[model samples]
Every structure is written in structure tokens, then in C-alpha cells.
Target: MPVPNRPVRGVAAGVPFLAVPPTRRLDQPAPVVVAWHPMDPPRTEAAFAAALPLDGLEAWRIYLGLPLCGSRSPAGGDEELMRLGYEDAVMNLQGPIAVQGAEEFPAALGALRGQLDLGDGPLALVGGSMGSAVVLLVLTEADRADDIAAAVLVSPMAQLRPAVDATGRRYGMTYPWGPASLAVARRLDFVARVDEIVRHGQPAVRLIVGARDDPDGFLAPGQRLVAGLADRYDDPARADLVVVADMAHALAEEPGVEPAPQTAPAAAVDRHAVHWLRRHLGGTAAPGLGAAGEEP
Candidate 1:
């Protein structure tokens, strides 16, 4: 499939452009991983690292770097995003930067569906931070939202107001910006949205949150996601949560900064998530580890 520079613009004038990677020829229906990278410039690396080791996926991968991070080429190659000015400030602040991306999801998803021929097989979503928020919105708002088989959310932010408040507490400064428009979050009904997806009969979701990830407002949402999905599944295979102690939401550590013990769980979290996806998406068995990476 050929990918042109053509972009799909929706109600929001500017957001992160969506990138659909090239597909490989397969004898069977190709599985799809539609991923949303964390909100920031260079969106590819951070979210990619966080969701690594997708053990059994032999399918096309579609990556969405939230508004301002730039995009990648479709040949499964990386292209440097132009030095857009707003990337820096938006990354540093917790505000409505990614709101456009969430709002524009229908267009993005449509473009991807057409490009990848998503009707071929199962679809899975992986998101981090702002990306996670967008995934939640898409799962609730898009008509095909319930069609997603499984989801893995890393440091998802359900409420930006609370996140900004948490950031102020951490840095001892006052920042009033919230994630999305307050009206939007309320209109969507964050918790209820998650429940709606479950009620529509989607499979389980994997949630990875940093126990020490204070600024992101991820802990609360991670808890709420589990609680919301509790009654939906008898086996409850869809509500998996892993709290990495002392870990923060940052995907990559700064040079010379020693990694915390809790940070090790990042890879473990990815493995657990992939294993679950494989099982649900019809992989042979759990990939090299059990769910949650628990020891037998």
C-alpha cells in the first residue's frame, strides 16, 4: 500500500498527524495494533519503548503520536518530525493539547481502517498518557469502538484537572491548565465511558501505572478502569492492573539518572500485556509468561 503526505483533518485544525505503517504479505488475516503514543514531540520513541515486546504479534502496527509529536512513514520506518514550535510547551504542560487528537479520532480511525483493511482481523489499542486518554475516548465515541479486542493503557489520564492539580502538589507551583476541556470530560463521563466499552462486550484491558506516577493522574484512572470492568467478565481476564512501585510516567530516563527498582516493571508490564493480547486475539498460548508476569 502506498502512503501519501495527505492528512485527514477534522474539527480540530491541528493535532498530531496519524501514521499507518506498511503491511507485510501474510497467508492468514493480519492482526493490527493501533497504538497512540504519549503526548509530546517525538511521540514515537517514548510510547514505543513503553509498549515493547509484543511477544506474538505478527501483524501491521499503526502508531498515532498525539498532536504535535509528528508522524512516521508507512514503510515501517522512522522520520524526524519537523521542529514545530508548540511541541515543547504542550509537552511540559498538562492541558488540552491532546484534546484535538481525541476529537479527531473518527477521521484518524477511518483513514487507518481504509489503509490497513482492518476488517481482516482483530484490533488492539495501546496508549500512554495523552495517548491513553485518546484511546478511551475513541473506544467510547467511535461507532466501531466496541470492535477493539483488547487494550493496554500506560499511565492513562481520565481527568486533566486532577492531573494538573497533582502536578502542582509535586512541583509546589500553580498551573491551572487541564487535560481536555472540562465540559468535554464531563460530557464523555470518563468512568462511565470505560464501563460503556465493557458493556458493549469488548475483551479485558491491561493497565500499567507507576505507583509513584503522581503528576500524570494515572493511578486514579488505573484504579477506576479495574473497578469499572470488574462485573463485566466472569473470568475477569480483561481487567489486568500492574502497579510499578516508585516508577514515574516518563518512558525513558535521563542520561546518568539511575533507574529505580520499580522501573524494571515496565518491560514486565509490556510482556504481561502482550501475553494477554495474544491469548485474546487467538495466539497459541500465553507468550513466555503468565498474565501479570506472575510466577507459577
Candidate 2:
């Protein structure tokens, strides 16, 4: 399939998104894959789309901006985000983003369905770092959990406690885990809620981590998630982990708020994600084309 020169930019239910339609399926209802970006490089919807455009895949790739990110950032910008992390990374930052992002997804999806030629078929999800937490929350808690066909997580925050601790270690400060924070941690901890994901549909889940990501925070938890889901999957291969060499936590260079040229590591991630989505969503389709405009 030929790649589009640019993605169709739009807002759905107040969420900014960069959408790329299937190259040859403008007349048909195409499979849709909604993605969320990490807090690191390729942090925004446009940037993530540039990094992992999923070219050649016969699906609509819609990259959505996470809460308090991109156009939704506070007035103080990155400084405000840092302050929130310093105040209480879990309660003030990570926890809220995951919860809000998950909560807002259904309305965003519905709006996108109304605005685009999206299929009613099972959806696919992709997320990175903290964004992955939102994806897990959706799988475990969303009313449409059973409508998920596949998911791909990069440097995922599968367990929240370890991630908070790891952040503390990196910044040389200890996070005083209190009752409220602990409760948030438990709620965001997807490892402990594997049964919920399995109860829904046990969608094909692929976790990709960089070789240099924090071992305790990201790598180990991702591995644990795959292991937890192993027995639950009828085809064990549906749940697996892939470690990319020469890659770190962030997928692109610094100042990842805007769209930029893709990095080597990001290209590698794109390949893995595209392959996984193609394999899983290849045969799926929407019943009819909606009001989405022509491909860009």
C-alpha cells in the first residue's frame, strides 16, 4: 500500500488526533487502531504518528493526544508538568493522566466514529510508557473492553509502584507512598488485574521494551504482564515481549512535543507495531463508510 504524504488532523470530543486512512480502502470501512504517546519523545499525537505511521497496513491509524499533553498542556508548560511530578508523581501526574485518558476514550472513539469511516469491528490499541497505563486501564475497565482486537505497548508502565520508585531513583528523591497514592498505585497496577483483561476478550497483546529502559520500572513489569497473560491466552503466542537493542525509554530526541523526523529507534518500533497490527487486524472491517473525508 502507498503511504499518505500527511495525516488528516482533527479533534474528537476535545481530543486532538492525527489520522491516517488505509491507502486503498477509502470506499470501505477500515479497521481502526487508536494510539497514545509516551511522556517521553514522540510525546504528542502528531509526533507519535510521525514516529510510527504504520505505513502499508490496511487500517486507519489514529494517534490521540494524552491528557495534559500537547495542546492540552497547562500554562506553565513542561515546568508545570515537572512541578506536578515533584509534588506527587502518582497522585498529581501519572494517576490522573491514566484515569482521565481512559475515561475520555469512549467519547473520543464515538466522535471519531461519527467523523471518520471507522468500522464497528474490534479495535486495536497502541501506547508507550505512561500512555501504556491508559491502554491497560481501557482493557481492564472500559465497557468496550471486549471490543479490543489487539494491543501493543512500548516501555509500558504495567505496574505503577515500581515506576514511581524508579522515577524516584532517577531523580534522587524518595516518593512517600501514602494511603491515597497507594490506592492509586493499586488501581493503575495492571499486573494485579490480569483477570480483568482476560475476562473481557484476552486481546492479542505485544509488549516492546528498549534494552536500556529502567529494569525494575518498565522492563520487569512488562515481562511480568506477558507472563501473567500467558496461561490465559488460548494461543500463548498472543502474549509476548520483544526487546529492541540499542534503544532507550524515549523513542525520539528531546523536545518531543511537536511532529519531527523519525529516529532510528522509532523506526524499529514502528516496524514491530505495524507487523503486530497487520497480523491481528488484517481481516477485520467496518460495515460501512461513515462521514470521514477523503484520505489526505
Candidate 3:
């Protein structure tokens, strides 16, 4: 199911609200949608604090919402990422901070669970990039293993090697503790821990990846991940790799930033995102955001 509008604009930018509320009544159970934040997200808590959207849909579809367990990308929460760039010799020393960052993920889950401590419904994780990977990490290591119902992974990372490599180059670290080196060495590689989650996380998983999204949407990020999972694409949606005509990487950039216009295929993928989200969260699936330009 594609989003109604192309590029899927958030009613508000920089603010991602989870639809689930705190006082969830037992008589009326609802699913909780946990959106894993991008690496080092801008505002982890504030993103979930805003009011979620409930219009457009036929029913009053709503669910518990929360950001995923952690962030690692360029969201800027990990102070160490920026701080390390200033000190070449000390950058590797600070690399441990990112590895240790996983510690915060579970805590966030615990907090979300506490907020939704009401009816016994279902919990689903919706994560993008490494945020999806972090969701796996939290669910695998948490006490409430049976709470999750399903998951949605968007362009997830294949391993930690890419992160380490990029971070090392950015910070000018000559030591072996670069993001890639440290990921495997520190045991934080996502691919290394899939088994732990496979046994615990349930229902099913829906993965959305751009056919052309190289690792980190460039090199071999998506490719490496897809290859790693080879025949395990249970419900895969490998969309066209068309870059939204004028869009940038940040689909939700700040004000004055022009939104990229995704082609019909991209629009369908985007709607599929919302469909999965609303269904697991509350709404039912409708026709996808695609039209008769091609295959059905």
C-alpha cells in the first residue's frame, strides 16, 4: 500500500509521533508501533512526544507509538561521533561509546512498555536503516521477549563493518577501532545476532529495500544485507531504485527544504510502508500507492 501523497510528508517535520497513548484501556487493545530512530537521531524523546496523525483513514485507527531502541546514523545524539572527529588519536578510544550505545536501546523499550502497561495486545517494531537493526538488538536482549508481534525493516544494515569504516574515515582514526573493525570485534554486528532474534521475535517481518540502494544507499549496504539473507526474504518488496526526481537523502529535512518527488514506483513503496504500519498498528490495507503503469 503506497502513501496517499507522494514522498509521504509528515504533518510536522523533525517530529515523529507514535499513535499509541499511555492510558490504553484493556477493553480496547491496540498495537504499539515502535519506530527505530536513525543513527544518533536529532530528538529521540521529542519525536515521540508530538501528536500523531489520525485523519484520512476511514476508521479512528491508532496504536501505541515510540521510537526504536537507539540511534546511530547522523542524527547527532551520540556525542562521541562528533567529538571523536576532533581527536585523531583519541577517536578510537571513544569508539567504544557507540558500541556501548546499545545499552540505551533496551532502556527505551522498557520505557515504552511501561507506558503501554495496559491491555495485552501486540507490539511491533518499525525501524529504518540501523534503527531497524537496533530493534532486533533490544528485543533479543530484553526480558519481555514475548511482547513483540511483528516487525518492519527498511534498508537495514547488513553488518557493522560499514559503519565502522565510515566513522573511522570521518574521524581520521588510524587505529583498528574504526566503526567497521569495532563492530565485529565488539560483537555489535547486526548480522551476527539474527539467530538470537529469529527465535524470539514473531508473527512475521516485512522488509522494504530499494533495488539500487547500495549499502547506506551507496556502496553495498542493501546489497550486502540482501545477499546475507539470501533466500530469507520472507516478504520482500524490492522497489525500483529511482531517486525521487529532486529528492535528497533526508526525506524529512527541515523547513525550506524542497521535498523530493518520488516516481510512481517509489510512491507505491511509500504507501506500502504506511499500509504495513497502519495494519499492524490499527488500519486495514487498501490499494497500494501504485497505478496501471506496469505489473500488478
Off by over 4 Å in 3: 1-27, 40-81, 85-118, 166-186, 201-203, 210-213, 216-249, 254-270, 278-296
> What is the alpha-carbon RMSD of candidate 2 to the true structure?
5.7
**Candidate 2: tens digits of C-alpha lDDT, residues 74-178:** 889999999988888888889899999999999999998878757575589999998899999999999979999999999899999998888788889999999
lDDT of each: 0.57, 0.85, 0.41
Where does candidate 2 clash, by residue pair? Answer: none
In model 1, the Cα lDDT at residue 57 comes to 52
lDDT of 3 at 80: 50
Cα deviation of 154, candidate 3, in Å:
3.2
Q: What lDDT tens digits, residue by residue, belong to model 1 across residues 1-296?
A: 43333323222133233333323345556667767766432145333533453544554556555654434223322322223212322343233445555677667666666654555677788777777777777776667776788888877666655654565576686644345445554643456566667755566687788777873466776677677777566667567787766667765443211222223656665666666666666662323435433321
Q: What is the lDDT of residue 172 in candidate 2?
A: 95
Per-model TM against the reference: 0.70, 0.91, 0.55
Query: Over the stretch 1-296, how does candidate 3's per-residue lDDT look in tens digits?
Result: 11122112121222233333422222344455555433322123223112112212222222211222223223563455445544542234323433333345445445544443424446666554455555555555656654666555555544555654545555575445556545443454545654555556343455565454433532355444344343343433421122223322222323211223333433544455545555554442233432322322
Q: What is the lDDT of candidate 3?
A: 0.41
Candidate 3, residue 184: Cα displacement in angstroms equals 5.2
TM-score of 2: 0.91
Give Cα distance to truth, residue 144, candidate 2, Å: 1.4
Q: Candidate 1 — which pairs collide?
A: 16-67, 204-238, 205-238
lDDT value for model 2: 0.85
